[model samples]
Target chain A: MRILGIDPGLTRCGVGVVDAEGRAVRLVAVDVLRSAADEPLEQRLHRIASGVEAAIVEHRPDAVALERVFAQHNVRSVMGVAQISGLVLRAAAANGIAVELHTPSEVKAAVTGYGQADKRQVGAMVQRILALESVPKPADAADALAIAICHAWSARSAAPTAALTPAQRAWQAAERASRR
Target chain B: MRILGIDPGLTRCGVGVVDAEGRAVRLVAVDVLRSAADEPLEQRLHRIASGVEAAIVEHRPDAVALERVFAQHNVRSVMGVAQISGLVLRAAAANGIAVELHTPSEVKAAVTGYGQADKRQVGAMVQRILALESVPKPADAADALAIAICHAWSARSAAPTAALTPAQRAWQAAERASRR
Candidate 1:
C-alpha cells in the first residue's frame, strides 16, 4: 500500500510517500511545502493544504502519516503548530485518507532504533534504510521521509481488515468527485 | 507615515494598513489572504509573499507591524509559528520597511483597553476605532487590523527619524532601480 508522510510546519512542511509490501518499501516522492515570510498565517496554511492535497492527488496514497505535536514551552508557538497540523489533518480527512499520527520519539525509534536521535543521525538512518545515495537535504524533508517509513512499517504489521471509517469513505467519495 | 499590520496564521491571514500622523490614524485597507485547505504550505507562502508585496507596493507603507509570537505549549507548534514569523520578517526586510513587533496582549490593550479582550470585543474595538459599520469578518483579519492600529499608536509615537538606515537606503535604491 502507498503511504504519504508529512512534517507540518507554518513556513515549510515536508512531505514524503512510499509504497510497502511486507518488509519492502519504495520511495515515491518527497517535497517541501513552502510559504513566503510576508503572507498571513491563513494564506500560508491554505498554501500548505493545497500543496499536500496536490501531492495526495498525484500519488493516490492509501494512507497518510503525520507527526503529532508535542508539548513545548511556548503557548503561541504551539498554537501555530497546532493550526498547521489542523490543516494537514483537515486536508487528509477531506480526501478520505486514513491518517496515522506518530510522536517524534516513535518516528525516531522506528526509523533509527532510538527515540532521541539527532537530526543528522536520523538522516543517515533514513538514507541507509531507504538505500539512497545521499541524505535528504533540508532536515525537514528527511524527517518527512522518516515519518513515512515509520508508517509503512507500522501498517505492515497492523491488521489489514481495518478499513476506512464511514465518514472517511464519504470524504473519499467527495474528493473523487471533486477531482473529476 | 503609513504602517501596515499583519496577523499571520496558517488558515487565513489578515492584513491592514493605516496612515499615522502623530496620534491620529486613518485606515487604508483591510483584507484577508485566503487559501484552499488542500494547498501546500510552500505555494501558499509564495502566494502570501506575493500578496503582501503587492499590498506594500500599492500602499507604499513606511513601516510594517507584526504580532510577536508568544510561547506555546507545543514544540512543533512553536516552530511552525516561528517559521511563519521568519517569513514575515524576511518579507519586510526584503522591502526595506521598518518592522516592529508587538505582543498579543499589547495589541489588545492598545485597541480594546484590556489585555485579555475576547475576539468579539477586539472586533468591536476595531470597528469603533476605524469608524466602520460592522466588525471585521474572520477573527484573524480583525486581529491584523488591530496590530496595525497598535503600531500606529505606539511605534508611530516613538517615530524613527525620516532618514533611512544604511541598509534601508541601499534597499530603497535597489528597489527604485528595479522599478525603473
Candidate 2:
C-alpha cells in the first residue's frame, strides 16, 4: 500500500509518500511546499492547494494521512494549519483518495514507540525505520514521513491476518526472520 | 456595487448578495446552502464550495464579504467555520473577486449603529434598511445580508468623496431626501 502524509501549514506544507509491504516500508518522496508569509491569504492558499494537488497527481497514493490540528496550539498558526488542511482535504477528496487524520501524539507513538517522544527522537526513529542515509530535512519533511509511517503501521495492524495476500504473508515471514 | 456575503459553516452556509448605490441598499439574493451532518468532511466541503462557486458565477458580484472567524468561538464549530472560510476565500480568489472579512461586531454596528446588537435587532435593522416587507428568515441568512451591507457601506466610505460617480451622488442625494 502507498500512503501520502501531509504536515499542513500555510507557509510551509510537508508532503511525504511511502510504500509499504507487510512490515517493511520505504520512502518514495518527501518535500516541503513553501509560500511567502507576506503574500495575500488567498494567494497563499492557492499556492498550497496547487502544490498539494500536484503532489497527489504525481504520487497517486492510495490514501492520505494528515496531522489533525488542535485549536489549543498557538492560536494564530493553528488557524493557518486548519485552513491549509481544508485545502488538502479537498484536494485529496477530489482525487478519490481516502484520508485519515492522526493526532500529533498518535504519530509520535507510532513512529518512536513513545507518545512523549520529542522531535529528535521521532526523527531518529524515522531514519532508523526507513533506513535512510539521513533524517529528512527541515523537520516538517521528517515529520510528514513519520506520519506516513504511522498510518502505514496502523493500517497493517488493522488488516486481518487471514486477509493477507500471499506476497504479504511472504514479506511478513521474511520480516520476522530478519528481526531474529 | 454588488457584494456577496458568506457566513461560512459546514452544515449550513449562509450566502447573501446586495447591490448598493451610495447609502441606498437593496437585496439581490439570499440563501442558505446546507449539507447533511452525517456526510463526510470532504463531501460537505465540496458541496459548500460548489454552492459558493455557482453563486459567484450567477451573480457576478463585484466583491465578497465573509464573516471573520475567531478562534475563541465555539471550539468545535470554529474549526468548521475556518475550514469553510478557507474554501470560500480560495473560490473568490479564483474568480478574481476581492474578499473582505468583517467581524461580527462590525456587521452589527454597520447595520444597527450598535456593535453589540443582538440577532433580532440586526435582522430588524436589515429589514428596515433594505425596506423589505419582512425580515429575512433564518438568522444565518440575515447575518449574511448584514455582512454584505457592512462591506457595501465600508467600501463606499473607503472611496474618496471626489471619486463618487454622478449616478452615485444622485442616488445619495435622493436617499437623503427620501429620509427627510
Candidate 3:
C-alpha cells in the first residue's frame, strides 16, 4: 500500500510519501512546500495547492492522509491551515484518491506510542521508525512522515494483510491481541 | 464595471453580480449554490468553486467581492467559511480578476446605514437599494448583493472618480470636502 501524508500550512506545507509492505513501512519521499508571507493570499494558496497537486501526481498514492484540525489557539494560523487543508483534500479528490484525516494526537500515538508526546519525541520517533540517519527538518516534514507512518501502521494493525506470509500474519494477530 | 459578490459558505454559497455605472449599481444576477453536509468536503468545495467560476465566466466581472471572515463563535463554521473564501479568491486570481473583501458590518452599513442592523433590516435595504419588488429569497442572496454594493460604494465614496464627468467630479469633490 502507498500513502501520501500532508501537514497542511500556508507558509510551509509538509508532504511525505510512504510504501507499506504488510507491517513494514518505508518512507519514499518527503519535502516542504513554502510560500512567502508577503505574497498575496490568493497566490500563496495557489502555490500551496499547486505544490500539493504536483506531489500527488508524482507519487500517485492510494490514499492521502492529512492532519485533522481541531480547536486552535491562534485564529489567524488556524484559518490558513484549514484553507490549505481544504485545497489538498480537493486536489486528492480530483485525482480520484481516497482521503483520510488523523489528528495530531493520533499520529503521535501511532508513531511514539504516546498521544501526548512532545515535538522532539515525535521527531525522534519518526526518524527511528523510518530508520533515517537524521530527523526530518522544520518539524513539518517530520510531522508529515509521522502522519504517513500512522496511516501505514493503522492499516496494518486494523486488518489482516493478505500480502503477509502465514507466519507473519499469525505474529501480527498475536501482537494485536497482546496490545489489546 | 462589473462586480461579482460571493457569500462564502460550505453548504450554501451565494453569488451576485452587478454592473456599476458611476454611482448607480444594477444587479445583473444572483443565485445560491448548495452542497449537502453529508457530501465529502472536497466535493462541497469543488461545487462552490465551480459555481463561482461559472458565474465569472458568464458575467465576466471586473472584480470579485467576498465577505471577510472575522472572529466567530462557531469554530467549525468559521473554518468552512474561510476555506470557501480561499477557493473563491483563488478562482478570481486565476481568471485575472481583482478581489476585495468586505466585512459583515461594512456590508450591513453600506446597505442599511446601520452597522449593527439585523438581518431583516439588511434584507429590506437590499431590496430597496436594488429597486426590487421583493426581497431576494434566502438571506444569502441578499447578503451577496449587499457585499457587492458595499464594494462599489466604498470605492466610489473613498476615492476620486477620474471617470466621472466634470460636473459629477466637482460634486464628488464637494461631497468629500463636506464629509471632512
Write candidate 3's Cα lDDT for B1-180 as tens digits. Answer: 677989999998989888766668898999999999999988888888788889998998877999998645588898788888888888887777778888899898888889999989988988888889999879999889889888878854323463678898678557644642
How would the candidate models be sorted by lDDT, starting from the highest?
2, 3, 1
| Residue-wise C-alpha lDDT for candidate 1, range A1-180, written one tens digit per residue | 678999877777899988765457777888988988697554665677678879988998777888987655345445556556655665565566667789999999988899999999999988998888899988889999999889878754323313567676577558745753
List the per-model TM-score of the A chain: 0.84, 0.88, 0.87
Evaluated at residue A57, the lDDT of candidate 1 is 86
Q: Which structure is stronger by DockQ: 1 or 2?
A: 2
Q: How close is candidate 2 to the true structure, as a TM-score?
A: 0.88
Please list the residue runs of candidate 1 whose C-alpha ends up more than 4 Å from where it truly belongs after superposition: A1-103, A106-110, A113-180, B36-50, B73-83, B155-180
Error of 2 at B130 (Å): 2.3
lDDT of 2 by residue, B52-87 (tens): 999999998878999999999888988888988998
The residue-by-residue lDDT of candidate 2 on A1-180, one tens digit each, is 678999999988899999876568899999999999998898888888888899988988777999999998898998888888888888777777778889999999999889999999988988999999998888899999999989888844435433688888779657644543
Estimated TM-score per prediction? Answer: 0.52, 0.88, 0.87
lDDT over C-alpha atoms for residue B83 of model 1: 45
Best prediction by DockQ: 2
- Candidate 3, which CAPRI tier? acceptable
By TM-score, highest first, what's the ranking? Answer: 2, 3, 1
Better of 1 and 3 by TM-score: 3
* Top candidate by lDDT: 2
Tell me the fnat of candidate 1: 0.06
Q: Each candidate's interface RMSD, rounded to one decimal?
A: 9.4, 0.9, 1.5
**DockQ for model 2?**
0.54
